[model samples]
Target: MLTSESRRRDFPTLDGRAYLNTAAEGVPPLAVGEALAQYFRDKQLGMDGRVPHAAQWEAARALTAEFLGLTAAEIGICSCSSEAYNLAALALQLQPGDEVICTDLDFPASSTPWLQPACPATLRLWKHRSGALHVEDLIPLLSPRTRLVNVSLVSFYNGFTVALPPIVEAVRKHSPALLGVDVTQAIGRIPLDLRGADLIVSSTHKWILASHGGGLVGVPKDRAKEWTAPAGGWFNLEDAFGPGSFEAVKSKPGAASFMVGMPNYPALYAVRAGLEYLRGVGVANIDAHARPLVLHCLTELRKLPVEVLTPDEPDHIAGILAFKHPKAAEINARLHAGNVHVMNPTGRLRVAVHGYNTHDDIERLLRELKAALAAV
Candidate 1:
């Protein structure tokens, strides 16, 4: 089983602090740094490093495919989650009278693309009730006019893990809409059965413990034929040609069609290292390790005055635990002063735990949080 003691050495950033902010930005492992260094070293080598870098990119894509339980052909690497979402939005090619449903709790990147003037679709929000989104609420919003339904597999704001299987079943029954899921918050932190989603996207830097500048997009084989590539370049084309010889071109099959330009090689290399590390530890084991900690945090927080936004049920929660407090920003600064890291966005505080986090880390956060709350 994966344990904090076994994984702590890989994350040197935890040496003098309790890092409970994987939700905001993950701290990369030592191996990821070494991977980036090696990328530069390899770049300085034979043939201007083109062959080696291309191979590394392909390897990274393959590793990402394994991580997401999708085939390599179904995966495309891009700059970030927003770009992935944009690609998905463009591919849908919504027409007038088409409606797309997004949750009110969604990060703007997931829904804003559908609201652009160029997109002819009407954007509808599946509103959350009392800090929670229910599948039943989403069901009524779905209809024949719905062309796409975008949702985050896990709520970035509150750590609520939306029950996707029910969402999938509901969408299949109520609408012809394709399901697009933002796995940015859930990826690398939980076990994902991605078969239900037609398209999925994530950034590499969060719970994956990688660097920024790279993102993942996947389209399962069964759904790949339904969309067209919005843009194309030599990397995505079936036939390569120089500027003078340019003509109409066709994209390669599946998600590879989304790779419109050169990839972020350095970030992709680090992503490969991060994905490799997670597979080595096993994601299921990581989930098990986190469950008790989440329960403990939830149980303890109930004794405090703050409103727990994350559900107490393990089925509805993941690595993050969020709470509402008017003094959240102040408390976040206090925790930072005490060398305990967490995220405070406006009125809520979010603390995230991962494979490298220990019970001691949670206790440290609790102690510091109590002090900070009292001081506030």
Candidate 2:
């Protein structure tokens, strides 16, 4: 197991407070802040060419690809995962009368773009059984008209992790549907091999511990040519500068073709630094440290009057734990008063535990929760 002492040093925020909000937004390390500062310093020195910018951008892409087990060409940088979904929705060749299936449990960012009125597609909602999108429940909704299936790898509210391999197989067997996944909740917190889906999208702000502007889209090599470039710009074409470039250049293959305009270079540098920090403390090691804390939180919540919404088994668990109390709103307010940060989505108090959290943190939260509950 990786040493918690060293891991805690990466995030200075943990020193002052008990931060249990990684699901909403991860706390970036000091190294990332230092790297962003260096980027601005370089920009002040008169570096203004595509080569230097593209090299930094490409290096970020390469590091992301290495983590996701994909080629650099398969990755595209986007402002956020929401934009990634919009790109997918626009680029997909969805004809009129086609059906696109997604879960009711998905974050609005994943569902709203496809459900837009102007889009020539019908949106189908899947039922959630105990926070899980079961294949049996979804299979009844799939029809010959179904063309795509989009689902979140983990539910944001209940922290229920989806079993995607069988769902992907069913989609392939039932119809000629494309599979897309919103892995924003599952990327760095959980072990993910994205080979089951055709298109995958995630934002680095959540689990990867990066800034807000960093996101990624991964596309399979075989279906690279099917989706058109959603919004074209100079970056989408080869030989962007030469004379007759517009006439001579072709769209780069795979998801990289979706990239347009200049990306936030400093943000990319910070994202790379964050990934490097995760790499130093191996992902499995991080998981070992995190899973126990989640279990501890769940165990403590079960002893209270509040209902535990997250799964009980370790296999179905992630870094997030959410529960509902009769006085959830009050509990959230009291926790905030105690300087314990967590997520309050609707009525559910979402507690996102990360590597920096310790057993004492869980004990403190439980003590505060009991006090808050007693007062209510």
Candidate 3:
């Protein structure tokens, strides 16, 4: 039910500018601003407003659970994707001789926890061939000594959507390792069925159209019995304020254990509003709206001198696209000065198309890009 015209008003920052940088950080809609203001009004009440603020956190948790196709009990809240990864690594308790597999194309946060000096697990990299990861390449890396396999559903450098189900099956057939997936780039932009993985983490800032602070983590029902958070706090206790509040710490079971402190309630208010907006305009509808923009941009970029890094196949791509350019830094600055926004990270230009973008935005980008390439 979402159309480019209908959602354009939600983002007022697009006042005569092309925004192709959702992969880095999203522009929050007007509704998110109102939610933050409401949080401040509630904060004026001091101790009396605690119930309502806690309600906002619960609402965001339930909505996130629905978006990822999991139960409320399976979901937990964190500060960001890095905190979620660190919490998961602490819970894993990998010992010496155990190996953890990470892709060479993965973001550093995905593998850094396993590489800490105190971590007993050995870190291994599954190198990507031709800027893409294959299932067969990952199969050989799995063994009985493997404790975990970490990967992102979509690459941050280039929009190469990995086939996760095959990798899940391979892990089950090969070893007893737990499969952990970072869905920061995949959650709100694409249609996802994440129940197959053991651990899933995502941040709400990018495709979710919200501010940062609410990081989501999910664990399937089968693993809840065995999963327990290693750290505890007042938030993790059963009777946080009631009688026996400080007597003996009794940790809450399941995903709630990950909430070791007072959550970022202000940002969670924005997450609640953002998730509500996505529900109003279905995620599938957003995906359908973005494919044509990606196709249009890709078709025009092929005529340019840059080498396209995103796959052309329909199944392996989503809203993001990347291309290699020698003078990418200079070109990126030119585009920004011309009011055309994009990212040039590590010598690759990344173009991220979202629901609010229209054909006019693509045309502006192509026009500015053509001029920038010629001058550089």
Candidate 4:
């Protein structure tokens, strides 16, 4: 049974703050905090002299795979979304004259790797129509030489959700181009079936309620054996490290091949703890609870002088709502003064309401926003 939790008891950070800056970073619940403390204690005690926490690391990978409705073989644990994207970029081995399609509205983290000088591929940028990603526009851009089509599942700048399945099907039907997705903003906040993307990369910091240096990458079964990470490390080796001639270090099969080095066990523990909590509550329940608050915020913001960046339709909304206000800086400062936290990125105030956020938080934010607008 999925119940709505319109309270702040689960998240301690919301004790005195509205904590609407989830797109910036998430506040872990009490369980993740305790897990981190235990990790530190184990490290200080020098238990097993290191490498003893390998099983826990495997569990984290399994949890991530389960969250995405994938097999354990598909998940690769990386430090951040950028690292995962880079791994995907290397696996494709983009040759000269090959083309890669991406959007101008997406975060640079998704596009920059393709643009990097290391790959000689031609980068094609498609402008988002009115800050909204239109799947139809890509029909003209894709060609037989298109090696990859990269896109963000959600716009970090404007909170606009991209309908990915249509685009993914379109590209796959025409060309052999791989669909790479940056889900840093979408994964934990939205319901993702993972049907379209061949390579999915996401950082768990924002919506997963985990700390930094923890991210995940997904590769399909067909691409698993074909993909090999550019960089090699011991963890990727199929052979064990102890009492062995280190001359032959073979990369592990599946997405684990991208792990350039030892996995971050400490951070992986925190990731597991947070992921466990989300599962307990159920993602559909979380979306059902948080989305209403976003709609409420969008409804009120529409009544103001600000220009709404997110789409007006219900299906288009996730956990974020961004609005362009001329007094964005002033309004942000005043909102901060009033203990309401939000992000002012790209001249628009980006408000992210998570599953744990309460209705009171939305009400307080609106009241403060109105006052700040008047004062400005």
Candidate 5:
């Protein structure tokens, strides 16, 4: 088991202020930063031309695959989750009048691609009453023409963790729809079994502790061949640099076909280091240590005048705790003024606790929050 003190050493930013905003962007560990800096220095020294770029990119892909419990061939390196969503939308073969079901609470990245006016697709929006979309509510929205059901594994604002297995089963049973997930919030903070999802998209910046501009897309093994590559670049070809390779050969199979261009190598190298760090700490153990801090925040916040929005059940919660006080903006301003940081999603305050956070940090946050409220 990794100790909190040792984990805290990994994040140098923890020395300055309380960082309770992993949901917005995680603090990359010193190792990842050093790896990225080394890559930058190597490039500056003109060693990038001598390095085996393909081998390094392939290794990065393999590391990401192992982290998500998928085959390397099933994972595609993307610039962001939004790009991954666009790839999934193009590959789904949606016909005219086909319906794409998504929730109102979904981040715009997951919904906007399907809403393109020229796409010849219909949008079915699921309503959220309490910042959550239950499976029962989704079932009523499903129709025979529904071709896809897209949702986030954990909501960005409220941190309501969806029960994905049952939702996948429900979608599969109700319609011949492809089930897609935006797992940006859930990837490193929670344990995910990717078998149930037909398509999964995530960014490495949050929770994974990677540099920005790196993302991942996971496609199911059985349905891999059904996806057609609409956006093609050199990296998507089997022999990208081979003689006459530009003659437009058949698209490579699986998630590799989704690759459009040369990936951000330095960002990927940093992501690889972050994945190695996550492996050393054990994602399950990280969740075990982090979840308690989230629960502690919830428990303590409930005692105050704040309205706790994140669910109390551990099974249905991620590392985020969201709440709203009557003077939420004022309280958040006060907290920030005191050198304590939290996320303000629109109006609600989101507190994301990660492995680097200690119980003392949570206590300090609670103290500051109470003081902020009193001042307000």
Candidate 6:
């Protein structure tokens, strides 16, 4: 039940503009900015006398865990989504004969790591079914040799929220391949539980609305023990001194082992602020507030000549609504001129809604979009 008025003043950009670009780069509120400033100031206080506080890092990670319905042990702080993906790719230890299936609709960060030479895994890029991701399409691609399946929980191009529960059930029943999700597009915007998946990764920038360079990877504590990938920073090990020799080191337990170096203090503080704000506002309430706005936009957008790429079904709808037109990029450019900020992701126009947005923002976007489309 957190309204725009309660949080609008926290975001400077929301003064008189429609910022429907949370998918690309979330606008950090004044709290996050102040936290960032305060972090550097405190860091300078110690000068050469202090180390990064591990306890603060854990608190921030716990905030993320609660937001995602995961445990702290399952969360491994990462510098970015690419880093998280890299850790997952290494942990899988795929070989020449091993096969990994990924959907073409996912962002490159989710698919490229498994395709690296180190893994040497056969890559299968499953095509979308009827312009959307479907379990039926992915099921046919899985086989016994499939060691992993990479997918985006939500599509960045079309704003399609991939229904994960059914897909996970089918994959586990049919193939030995483990499921991995890139949650960059859907984490804070939707409800996510990591109970059934093998692993999941996310950057704090998008839906969590935090520092851009911060990320985390989630894996069960037992799975973390069996991981083969060696993230080589000294701090990643539990015993860096190694009793007498550095060779005797072992990685810290669970996802924390994935932290290769010192965590960025500034980003960590920003994450704490962002996560605290979300906790106060409530993720469920945010989802309820945003979904109606997106559905309203989708319903009204269909009246225009543009082709809506995102599915209208309840299973597929998310905070994002993407539309395609011959002059999509031009229309978005004009919308920007009119102070309506939407994304031109490739050729599609994507409007992203978040907790801080108001119904009036979407109304202005529609009015501006109508004018922009006509002008284009």
| Residue pairs with backbone overlap in model 3 | none
Clash totals for all candidate models? 0, 0, 0, 0, 0, 0
Which residue ranges in model 5 land beyond 4 Å of their true spot? 1-4, 44-52, 239-249
* Superposition TM-score, candidate 5 onto the true structure: 0.93
lDDT at residue 223 of model 5 (Cα atoms): 69
Count of backbone collisions within predicted model 5 = 0
Please give the lDDT score at residue 201 for candidate 3. Answer: 87
> Which digits, one per residue and each the tens of the lDDT, describe model 4 over residues 218-281?
8877777656675567777677475563665566765887787877877888888888888888
Q: TM-score: which candidate is best? A: 1
Give the per-residue lDDT of model 3 (tens digit) for 216-248. 888777876445566767685577787776676
Cα RMSDs of all predictions?
Answer: 1.7, 2.1, 1.9, 2.4, 2.1, 1.9
Q: Is candidate 3 or candidate 6 better by TM-score?
A: 3
Cα lDDT of model 1 by residue, 48-129, tens digit: 7888788878888898888788988788998898887877776777789999999987888999998788989899999988
Native-vs-model 5 lDDT?
A: 0.81
All models: lDDT?
0.85, 0.80, 0.85, 0.81, 0.81, 0.80
- What TM-score, over all chains together, does every model reach? 0.96, 0.94, 0.95, 0.93, 0.93, 0.94
lDDT of 6 by residue, 1-376 (tens): 2465666677766788888999998888788898888777677878541344455587888987786667887777778888877877766767788898988888888888776666788899878865688788788888999988878888887888877788888788889888888888888888776566777788888877788778777776656654434667766777776664455656676577678787877788888888887777777889988888988999999898899988777668778888899999889889999889999977899989998888988999999988987787
Once fitted onto the true fold, the runs of candidate 2 whose alpha carbons sit more than 4 angstroms away are 1-4, 48-52, 239-250
lDDT of 2 by residue, 1-376 (tens): 1355664666656775677898998988788898788777767767564455567788888878887778887888878888777877777868898999989878888889877888899999997776666788888878889978998888887787877788988898888888888888887777777777888888888888888887788887887875546466777666578888766666676687667767878778877888888877667778888888888789878888988887676677788888887789999899888878888878889999877777877887888888899999
Pick the winner on TM-score between candidates 2 and 3: 3
Q: Please report the TM-score between candidate 3 and the true structure.
A: 0.95
Per-residue lDDT of 252-357 in model 5, one digit per residue for the tens? 6668777878778887887888888887888899898888888878889889988888766677788888998778888889988877889876889999988887
Candidate 1: where are CA atoms >4 Å away?
Answer: 1-5, 46-48, 242-245
**Which wins on lDDT, candidate 3 or candidate 4?**
3
